[model samples]
Target: MSTSETTTMTAPNPAAARIPKKTVKDFKFIKEIGSGSYSTVFLAIESGTNRELAIKAVSKELVTRTKKISQVFREKDILALLTDCSYAVKLYCTFQDERTLYFGLTYCPNGDLLQYITDAGHLEEEVVRFYAAEIIEALEQLHNRHIVHRDLKPENILLTDDMHIQLTDFGSGVIMDNNDSPPQSNGTKNVDEEKKPIKRTNSFVGTAQFVAPEILKRGAIHVGSDLWSLGCIIYQMTTGKHLFRGHHEYDIYNAVARVSYKLPDDFPPLITDLVQNLVRLEPSERLGSEETGGMEKLKSHAFFSQFSYDTKWGNLLNQRSPLETKVKLSSRPKLSNDELETMSSGFDDRVEARLIGLRMASDAPNGIDAIVTGSSNISLSNETSSLHETDNQSTLSDQSSTKSMYNSPSSNSSFNNNAPVIARRLQMPDHALSLSEQASKNVYHKFVQNNLIIKQGILDKKKGLFAKRRMFLITEGPAIFYVDPDAMELKGTISWTADLRIEQKDMKTFLIHVPGRTYYLTDPDQDANTWCKSLISIHYRYYNTDPNRKLSTTTSYSSSSSSSAMQTIVPVTEL
Candidate 1:
């Protein structure tokens, strides 16, 4: 029997006909695990079987607003089709209500592959080979059914408890049949068409760095496109960086189109050869392309010579993963009823704060009095008066240093104690720019010029009673600044001195400690490790480059210290 026929005979169907009538009430939601543009995934317990499942709740209103109704249905259809595949996320059932649609999928307690990669910096070559082989098996199953997963990235590859891979997110996928003709060659196009420029798609889909050259060129997407993404993922697995990266999408597209990239000097020759063969500019020339020798050609490569699919494929799930020793799956904490309710509605306050430009404790000049109250109200008059008091107390040397730090000609003088404070109403920029653009222009130009911005992203800063969103920029000056992205105003800066330290409280929460104060911060993307690593790297870079910098006499705290040691350390009241 064919692979498809065997899969059909063995796997149980999870269609609407087989599933019983169910509703959202059938499951008890524990907490939200992940979210996307249109859907939020909640970790829930099935009441009947007491099984943990990840319930992807799609907002019907968002679907209608974004005109993605068809896309939602397509994902459901695709998930149902993949019920037989061990490497794909299994969908048990689907249900909907007045406001939301829910899909109950097998929950992977261990997080996505991105989190693992980020934590480890990069995987060992042996580990990379194991994961790559499983990914190839998954892709073979998809391609056998004529399904093309256009969006393939580490974030979409979830890890199970046993460290096995389960591919998810089929929203961007499409099915191709034998009747579909191959993409036309550049030379075959009409003369008039050749002269016209290639316009970008109205809504660009898929992650920019992993997208294939053919897809960027507006050519027909075939199975070869997936191999390109696989190559990119493998490269990143070996090196803690993207194969093709840029400050903007256009730059990444240009590099991909020209196949412009250099492997790291330390890259192993075997892995490098495998990646080069897979990411060829011409899809047909890729190692696994049908025109070439197909997947067997890739399987026979020296890099994967140790992994014999014929002997190992059936027992792959039983084998222990190499990452099993390195990564430990943490147990999820049980939440109280009040905590659950609070979390369900907690995001609304953030949205309102962003809309009205509510200043947090960190944003104010004095920082203490400007604390956002429980009601989310700020007393601007008191803050302004405090700013005036600070200006009167500033020394001549302090004033000069402040001026030199943030002397922008376009805006009112940068917020310093020596200047009269102006309450500028926050407004959107004239042209819309991505988050990276805003960071480059506002953070780089206004604060650290010439110094490299190591990392910048939105992080929630926990103040006295509430958490407020802020754009954080980490620079090579070994300095960290939290800014109001809307107003492009600098709020406060944290210098990464020798005494500064970081503590990871949990997956999302982390604490930064200076001499007297501790800053409680949380990453919405659950990348606390990345933030801590970047800050530590900057600190090392700064001290190593400048030999004359004196070390402080204050007691230094290590990140590996027990969390119990932080019990007495209070969150910073002032910036």
Candidate 2:
């Protein structure tokens, strides 16, 4: 272990699950190892085995706790399956004791690659070659199993006790089977209709520091994404600087696509050549040149001419680094103390505001009520309070959709009374339908669960006080949904617009009458008040008065399409 750095393994409180009385609970409990959004890890000792290991205990209701529930399952399932693989963490066992799920695994006493980088400003060319070789070899093993460890960054690449590299987290890894859909490991449906040529996902769920250009560009990707990420790590090691550390997605993509970065003037030509190719915006033309060509070609490169894999890198890092990366980068984006404090304050305000709104919208009149009064005549009352509460808790706890909703300023809204009301209102532009949530969850009170559908031409805007509404056509993986977009406008007036389709039906659409209050109504019997909390009670912009531009342009909708300007929420895990 690195200078008194202790390690241990743990399981859920055995007593909670009636652990056998003689299981021998004598292992010493150490401090926490890692704390992430869904889990916390601790290092503990195994009294029986007299060995140390890392124990990860996750919430049993990880589904409710995590928005992307499949990801949690993916992590546990992949880790447990790959315990036999030398390049991956060795999972000891998986067990549950009531409210928590546990994983006992071998501990990495050397910490992660990030710790190594933190101790060294920049790796020597020879050192970089060694780590790079190990990482690619590890990735190859994972690919052989048809797994793509999508979230690859320094933090996830840990060094085992003997200094060999081990890939730790597989939360984002998707088992893309070219054959029939890999039997849905978790609760994730086959999305059979969504089956197509395995390609890169434009919508990302990984850290920006190591994301590929294809992901940034809203383009298709495959195993090649892994190579691109590896290139970023290579650059970080050599330069001791982040490759694409930008705030916005555009800046990140631009850097990856255009190589808008500066490197040391003496950077070896062979090293530069490899970096460029690995960071190539196109996957087919990425590094290694051929399937088995990665390590072979990399070995032959002139940059590694001084290296010998035999005894060359056995314990070079154990010898220690000269300086840390944070010290080497003088040009790193520096935030002043005052600036950090101000930014923190702003973030807290936004979070508080959002929490208040979410609590309200989810309260009295939210999804449950939306169904009862609108399309479905199902009633939610005393007899179904228990079911309603449980469903409400599930929706609030689900991490996928609402995280983006809370983070986004443009999408979330509240009503404002002082705002100028639209005086001469015409039909709302058909394009206003863009604001609706693309992933529609229809909570049928009678069914008392979530209905997953991509609703199309959903009733959006009510043409009048009581009229057929403007609806948006939304698509996800392989389904389509119709969403109604009736938002409040100037004071209490409903900005009325009619899609030619809704105009034909002429059905009376519903609207909340308060001037600037966006309340989630409970689907109660006609007697009770349903509004929970107020997310935003505001009128959507009526329309930009421009006759030259066509309103609601005929944009083709496809579930497979990746142009997600409107919210297509996906929860990103550290793994």
Candidate 3:
């Protein structure tokens, strides 16, 4: 999954006095359990409480100077309202002192649902149903309060030692309505009569692989978006894959807009029906809440024929007792002496120069009007659109600066303050780029298909089409991991993926597909012309002697990286 963009929650200082620095040594920093773009979560013994808690340590200064403080607050707000489930990770309390915001909460010893599924390859029907039922119940609670958990995917759902689920991370959730009034946009103001309007909304918000179709298209949507995402997750759980895994972000959004699901022959009947209904193109056509068949109504469908929400899961809504609130941290995300200096020297000359150039230019080819040349909103003309569709993307590319500023309505002060991540204009990183690169690198290294190559010691059966992931143990090629491929209209298998991690070197990992009964020479590059010929000869000497056999591996190796690589040839060992 792409790391959800984090918003800094640092309170602004009246004067730009230097922020104080902190050493992790202050709190009994326990095991470094996990990390994301803006924070690190540790399994620690909170001095406040004698119990083990998960401390989500985010650099308040990092997110704020970068400008996502309001987004951080939104996460806190969403977590606070959802003190409803045993399956949802309980957020004990959120408080801040200076450098870090400490969230005192329960630690799931079992990690997340991905580990369980990766360990088992796919989920059993009962398990998938039970979990889905739990999620549906949770969705009902969230929707009742007018909150939308925009990002719903497997990794965000945690698993306890007993294997029950606990959903965490509300960073991407949006409160659709506040105080019975229409919710305000996040710092987005009404378009000026003089200025051109921006296109669709974009965010480092939701993880793309599991994002709902409606969310991607920026269409009229509500909590049902979560159900569509739920359908994606459910399909992955039962079939070991996503229902409509796309090759790119635009592709993912495109598929979501259509709401079409392609099921494989091996998929279960009940699962097929359930996912299809959940992923219906029109939000009202899908299951749960206000659709033609409401969630309570859906509980009675044949796919859920064996289930009875009233007799079974309905009891969850009636529970009243709260888990004893034990630990609350007044600790805020802090900066270190050196980090403060690095942050203060935070201006990106490259980004500044680029923005300056854009500001000075007068000509924008007529159709690219919706987007501010280099923003996440792609330019799509209502008509006369490009025949050959391509993703012309750009990014905000500064250290921690936000240059675009517009005023909000006088009383509309409720939106988050997340700073846009700086990205390069022409060469920004694509979504799910990690999957393509990893597929190219790992598959290329192994002369043949070898699961052992990926597993040396890190083998897992739980990670699925949408969730299984591991770090690079060797600093070799692009980090690679497997996600199950889904059936698509075009042809063959299609799949989705999480992001590639590069900050750490020991994280290098990869994948390959070798035909059985045929010993073949490895194609460092997945080139078609040369690879097609390589498929015919069994002798390595043939490859060594012929200059015609050479081809680039750049394309075929990584969907994102290898334009030079070739796909594995169809089996014809008899030749």
Candidate 4:
């Protein structure tokens, strides 16, 4: 997932300032637990305390290169601020070396919600309610602090040994001023209300699958966006599939804008209702939007009515986790010294120049526009648009820092007060530049399909023929497509093709025959032949016909209001 652009390098209060810091040598590394483009998480044991912890190591060079130093500082500050909140991942301390910065965090023995969901396929209603309630509590704590957890997803929700969930990863969070008067629940200002326009930050961040409509539109985001993500997590837990499954960035964006998914009929009405309300297309109408009492409405939602909304939720720490892992966490792949070096080198002079722009910019931008470009295994391109500019500034670069200016005893007031102005023009990072081309391939290859195809096609998953022209990506998991690239409506799989068969429709088009649906795709005759060949290869790789190949059977169905019918089958054969 992408990290946040908002910058807060120091804690906002004295209590937060008191969080201790330890040297990296104070902990003994156990093994790698998690990894992303910018950082790596490891299991470690504190030498003096003999306590287990998860230590996230981030490359200082890479951070400086990507111009995300503010995000790093922001995460540290937020974690410290939430140290006493049991619902969030606790920050034990922080440490840094010349090369890397380290964050000592509470180790969740049961892994992340994503792992649990993968193991269980779909969680039972009771279990979903349990986790969702805890997540709501966490959000409440954050919202009360005027912080928006911009990155909320299963991967960021960690599980304690006793099955309780903790919200982690604040790198993508936004911290607003709590001193400001609250906006009306309707999120609109009356003419009689304060004349000051409500502060709204515009940035494109967070994972594609879980982004909210407001975020996708490249508009301003608020607490409501987090509620939308919560809805997605709940739906994913209940169905073992992302509410918005897309082939790539464009597809995910489309789903975010449309809110086209439907809850399974078997889902309790309350659960279905909660998900729908939370993910409403209109931000103000969302369950916890500013127009609402923020987290209060979320807590009182029907889906969580049965769960107690209190600190730690009473005795959850002693309860057994709903999902269990058979293998030791240390079994995850470890990074080699050479791999680490390569990751560290991901940033260059251009990247550092961008960081300078972010740190020095004065006139704050209103919206973020992205142009993904890069060749490495990891990179994302992002650009900020100034409200004053008629034409978008080309090539994305991190925007100005929102350094918090506080008078806490430990505050570095001088640095915060006199922050530099970011440069007007900057280039996007390489990984960001390649997000469209690489992120899909990387995420799908590692977690979903080992192979996939990216191209234009029509998706008739729920609408039958004449569905809008779209881009289709066929992976091992599903045939994901996008009806509206920016809106992010994930047109789900229309058929399971055992094999791909192409029939010529005309000189400008060809028909692809899959298991249950035949798609007529338009392409020049020359390219049509290649498209057919590639589609066949992709399908064959997914459902290998090798005689020695093992067979697995699993029933699948969609709950979209347009297609509620179900089917069961046995035996594996040709499409």
Candidate 5:
């Protein structure tokens, strides 16, 4: 039997039905690997099977508040439906608690395609073809079941440990009734349906950059909608950038509506043809659409000429991946500082402040008093500062009395009074701090010397193709410092100037343009707007404060046949 026929005949995995009996206690959670608006995915081990699984824990309260209960259940149903599909994530079982619902799925340790592509820069055409074929096959199975994946992007495509592709995240998928006709090899459809210009839908779905033009125009989603997204993913894989990009969602929508884009100068013509064909403005005209030749037409494209669907494609999972040498299994999983802080509730903030104060005192130019009375505009906390001040004062007083007793001729009479303080000091022995603690001291001093911290938090810093988790500290000097949170090491610093510009890329992402480089950062808490506004405000404050600053300008003269001349100079400022 053909692959599609075989997949269609396969029975749903019986394990999906055995739900609700199990509980969270049945599994041992390792650590959280990813999180979304309402769900968090953890690397866990199922006690019953003793196998590694990705357990997705969904917040019941958040889902209800957002009215996404239907989407949650729909995803569960879709995952169950796809249980037997090898190209898709397998659902082992599901269970729930009072506060959260959970899904036990096959763990793909290689991470998602977006991260993979990012780490690898741009994949070779051959590598892209290998992964694309697997995605196409997965889509074939979904379409055969009369399901359209409304949201298909690189983030939704995960890589198995062995590097095979597994299409996941079916929350936006729509399942048509059995009465609806599936896409056929030959171009054929109902006469009345074919006559319509476009199908309409009131609700919008999918990522802004990857959504098809028809979707942006309020057109209903179909199998063709996914093909357009696949094309965008292919472009990103080949070029390492989005095909349609903008600073805002509406800008991206405008670009998609106009079909405005330019390919890289070195882009291969054959790949260009395939991408253009797949992203055609009319959904019905797109390659692989039911009105076209469906999956057969897409497979026949020159870009995937090396693989034969009948034999070679079926065994892709067994073959060695092109990225075999590049892909390395992590020896150990280190929890990020964000994750650590979330898991460690017993971590005392006051204790941390005291530790930091001790370290600061050791490095301060004027001893403990310098740190206690430093000219810092930023305060860690009101309670922390007060506690630190009181502790420092008490220690200093004890030391002063001890010194007086030792140096004075009336020392014998004061001995009893100073003995307890000396004994207390002796009891608190001095020892070397750990590397992380020492590094924290250095970081703290570095911030203090630069006018102290204004705002500090964990954010993802985009470096080349990888997004690294960094502890970022913004200082009163209008400087930005990103540090390795785990190691407490300073990575880089960006000092603000009149030429500096801060741009908000989206709700969570922003860009900092310096003189020579632009830093891309993403906040997990969706606080990019606040970050941008604060940075701009600080920049203006500094600019206005500088009395020695000059209004640097350039002269531009109008060239006209008439002897009249016009000079224009635009003043540069923070945006």
Candidate 6:
């Protein structure tokens, strides 16, 4: 281990779970290894055999707050299912505590491919092929299982003790079960239709830079999408930078949407051809798509055959990787004061503002919302308690039509006369309304949670009564507020995640603060008042149960799980 980096493994705490009493005391904590927003990876030792392994400890509360319940379940299932695949990571056992969940996994001592790439800046041709071949093999295994690995960056590719590659991180993966109707050769049909050559998904997920064109266009993706990401990784391996890097995340999205990127001029022709075949704009044009001979074309590519067409492909692992590809550990230097300040400042507010505007305008299917107000006719509400009982009577309804319920004057007139008198005349454009309704539908079923539409007040006093009527859905997360609802005129969008602070500024008004933005909302409309209170409630629930809040590190012991002990034993103890 590097001198500056400490590896930690926690000793099992008996009181953590209700399973076997003995399970908690089985593994001994050694040192802290790595940590993420919601989980920590530990380098632990099994007491029975004294064998070291890597275990991931994730907080249940954090997972729930992040709305990654499906991901958590999918990752666990994929790891367990792909244990036999040599190119995939192995999972031993899983156990959870009242505060955290644990997954015992094989330790990759040499670290990930990303670090090696950073150290070398770029890899040689032979080295890229070796890694690329292994990755292709890994993709083959995943594809055969009908699983699409939506995220495929170098960080998820770990190196074994011998420096061989093993794929990890299945959190963004999708498993194709019988429930989904496969897309037909001509096109996709409803879910009830018969199976076809491909499965189409509309989920907007995956790392921004590496996302495929199909994903950005229609939220539809197939197994071949992995090939597109693979092509990007191959390009990065040879050039040491992303093929589709833009000025910002949204720029990257636009680039992916158009497949507008150029490979290095110095790139080898054979390798270049291979990459081009994989990264075609249309899914069907990609090398591994059903129309393109799938894995056969990839395996038959000239680049892989450069080693020797007659040689058994798996035997390529026997050939030692280039000496330069080996990882060299170095101590991390302390950050300077200026660097510290920059790091602490989070994101640049100006850049974030622009990015948010672009995202809100382009991301949703309906494009952008149009807020058209007639004459100043209605007053805003200032007191939550003053909301009429009639406002509470209207329950949450589906947004199936383009016409917004906010424009109805009957709901807006109940506001206090002393409150700001903003015109209640609101008109949503057909495109924007349709998209918002679609977003609402997707959120309702995808999250498996009921979405409550509540009126939220705009806090900006400068905007006055002309501010757009904002929608709030506690379960949907990340409240998206429009500075201007019109698409063509002066307009922008500001969004806040569930993790931010939401404070009740007054009886009917609330304030939301994220890193670079602050939003205010006040509504005397019964529905708006109810929504504001709901926002306050949701904020407190998340804040009070902060997963990162320091918990009792000292564990209480009972007996350990015999099964857990037996499962963690490994042949190689260290990398």
Best by TM-score: 1
Query: Distance (Å) between predicted and true CA of 384, model 3?
Result: 43
Local distance difference test, per candidate?
Answer: 0.62, 0.44, 0.44, 0.54, 0.60, 0.52
What lDDT would candidate 2 get against the real structure? Answer: 0.44
Best by lDDT: 1
Ranking by TM-score: 1, 5, 4, 6, 3, 2
Worst 10 residues of 6 by lDDT: 370-379
* Alpha-carbon RMSD, each predicted model: 14.4, 20.2, 21.6, 22.2, 22.1, 21.0
Residues 147-173 of candidate 2: C-alpha lDDT, one tens digit per residue = 667788877888764566788877766
How many clashing pairs per prediction, in order?
0, 57, 59, 26, 0, 19
Error of 5 at 196 (Å): 21
Residue 510 shift from truth in candidate 1, angstroms: 9.4
What pairs collide in candidate 1?
none
Query: Per-residue lDDT of 49-72 in model 3, one digit per residue for the tens?
Result: 335667686667656553455566
- Candidate 1 lDDT over 1-575, as tens digits, reads 33432333344434534544568767766555666656767777766476788988787776665555656665766677778888899889788877778898989989888888877889988789889888898898887766678789888899998899999998877545322353233212333432321211223457778888877876755678899999999998998689996543455778999999999898999999999999999988888878778888888888987764543754667787888887777776656556544433212345325322422333323443322111112111111100111111110111222222223232342222122111111122322232244445443445543333446676767653234456776643345767654445666776455456555545566667555565778776465655654453334333322211222434555553322223212223233
Residues 230-310 of candidate 6 have per-residue lDDT tens digits of 999999888888888642344577888888888878889998898889888887788867677777778889888776544
Q: Per-residue lDDT tens digits of candidate 4, residues 390-489?
A: 1111111124221211112224211221121111111233323343444443333232122223333332221211123344554322243333333344
Candidate 5: minimum summed lDDT over ten consecutive residues — where?
Answer: 561-570
The C-alpha stretches of model 5 lying farther than 4 A from their native spots are 1-20, 178-202, 307-311, 332-575
Tell me the TM-score of each prediction against the true structure: 0.60, 0.47, 0.51, 0.55, 0.57, 0.52
At residue 98, candidate 5 shows an lDDT of 76
* Candidate 4 C-alpha error for residue 58, in Å: 0.4
Question: lDDT of model 1 at residue 171?
Answer: 80
Worst 10 residues of 1 by lDDT: 382-391
Per-residue error for 226 in candidate 4, Å, reads 1.1
For candidate 4, the TM-score is: 0.55
